[model samples]
Target: MQSQPVLLTAGPRHELPVTWQLSGHARRLVSVAVAGLLIAVITRRPEFVGLAAPALLLLLPGRGRQPDHLGIEIATPAGQVTEGSQAAVGVRISGQGAGQVRLRLHPGNWISLAGESPGEDGWFNFRFVPGRWGARQLGTLEVVIFDRWRLAACRVLTSLPPVICYPEPARLGSLVVLSKLPARLGEHTSRRPGEGVEFAGVREFVPGDRQRRINWPATTRRGTLQLNTFTAERAQTTVILMDISVDVGAAGRSSADLAVRAAAGTAAAYLAARDRVGLISYGKHLRWIAPAAGRRQAERISYLIAAGAGPPYPLEMLGSLAGDILPPGALVIVFSPLLTLRLIESLRALRERGFAAVVVDVLTAQPGTGHGRYRATADLARRIWRMEQEAIRFSLREIGIPVVHWDGQSALDEPLAPFTRRQVVSR
Candidate 1:
């Protein structure tokens, strides 16, 4: 990894001279000074003394001493938290004597901050819930200092620091059943005999056979040497394809969140099986990690899944990435809302090329239905749309693509168990 650049802040050698500016109180004071002078000179009124006295009193307070020694710094621990988890952040005000500090925090769009402003002390602590994944940004913090009279004030916003948020995969037990795994050096048993725990059969002891494997009972019955054989355990390659073409479902949140969470859970489960896992984020931009086995590969895949997708592009481009981007013989599991035609065509293209493709349908029902006037027409249109969707799903299943509809909160074991059993039996 490349080294990160250091940031230069305004402190110590890079410190700036303390400065103060006229507040809104100064503006009001000027109006009062003008009115007092106008009343005395124009009307020769003695009552102007009261107005002039108050203006002088307010202006005199500012002249004596204005607080300028104020600086803001943010103190946060260097660590990580999962999405939807809350993290405590602190903002400390340094070099006081600047009257009462009224702090207002803005923790950006990625985090949901829930806490009051600063108390009597100069410290501000808040619990913020992380909504987006990967390198969460804590927004700008604004502090407005009020003088003793609450009239004059100074407003300053502290700069945001570097904060990285890591993606947290869902907790899945040993119930996640995947498709039939290909033959490789791994945990799953292979058809042919090799070195494994499962008993295969017995054969005449060869020169390379271990003596411990010479089945004594069988050798005694046949009066010959025989060696036990075990099936070789092999792992398969699984690739997660995330389709982020269009985000149109909920009001406050988009469908991308559900898609990402599902992808993360699936990746974690397959990697736990000691299989080679890879990832490909398809949308306006294409990001992919090739298949590999190890702890680092799993972490890399998880990071890419949570690293928010790029802007939307034309969907036609995705159909062209058959053999060029992804390697052959890797099972492709796509998580998508299936809102566009180009996305459908892209999946079809992948299957046409002989890749074992599966689609996790993340698209749920629309929130609200139609109103009074266009009610009948809207209902008819919706019925037709649903019918078309059913046909599309059936077509995919017929072509050997398992279309799994994900319940946002349930375990995926039930849906995947059939797929796993079917593939294993076929193999």
Candidate 2:
């Protein structure tokens, strides 16, 4: 694999006075002064020439040029992490031919090297705590260097590799009661369809039953009886549908971030339960990855989410869906802030296609408007928007689709329980 490019920054440096020789203004001023001085001496006006020459010299044009250089190397963390874990990052900077190079970092999260002079080689070590499970681009590093005289400048750009932060698997005790599901779904059984390790019942021998499942002892116990027991085991396919529309902007936070967290959490949960998981991101553009199982799929999805919001690629929902963006019979869970009409229509269409669709509404409660004419109007507009959102929710339910409203303020399970309960009953 090709190595990442190393970035270099040079601080301001003192160059030889040759920089003055390159100035046209300086040469012109010197020539004019020389001619005036010669005329003054020939005319026998030494005192008058002395005053004029010094003033003329002051008007001479001259400029100074300083040299500066800078270099930066950054080390990023590895993929994957446990809840409450932290990742370490290292940044090194060196200056050449430059006076003290001052640095400014964007995104503010990165800490600077301690006790190091701005112009000298220094090392900065810092840690980032990825609190929630999901994929994330830690942030950007903005480096600025200046010359000793603070005149000339340059810049560099670099993108850190994506990181996958998996959710801590739900503990057994915390898992919703799967009691409604047949006990067979819980145990390991033969790889055959509808048979799991959890005993379901015994029936006359079937052609597909493994000889190991043949209850020979039971056969002898019951004269002339040959039978096999079966259990329940099936793999589910889960599709995470995320909304990247601009309308989700109502909530002070970007809808994209919440959508990523929800998608990541749900995907991780389903994967842990041995289900096939896929992802589809809808905005101005459609991003789709087919259903697959295992760690790599999770990594792929996380990387996409970490890249953050981009201009939506223009495309119709049906066109994308028909093009294999989502598989038939996949349980499609949408994480959106309920911003646009297009998103609502898309969800309705997905349900019409017979997909088990769920919507996790990421709600953001706006702060109360302060006293002002403009504030009053804004508050009224917010009320209208909320009403519209409720109507959308009602419309979705009318079409037999379940909606889960989620706000980052609370635990995810709070909103999830109701929807999951309804799902069991609907099944």
Give me the candidate number with maximum lDDT.
1
- lDDT for each candidate structure: 0.68, 0.57
Candidate 1 lDDT score at position 53: 79
Clashes in candidate 1: how many? 2
Give per-residue CA lDDT, model 1, range 226-270, as digits (tens). 888897777867778887667666632355766777778878887
Tens digit of per-residue lDDT, candidate 2, span 248-310? 444224465567667777777777776677888776677777777788887776656645433
Instruction: Please give the lDDT score for candidate 1.
Output: 0.68
Best by TM-score: 1
Worst 10 residues of 1 by lDDT: 6-15
Q: Which stretches in model 1 have alpha-carbon errors above 4 Å?
A: 1-61, 64-71, 75-77, 95-100, 116-124, 132-137, 147-151, 158-168, 174-184, 201-204, 217-226, 251-254, 308-325, 421-427
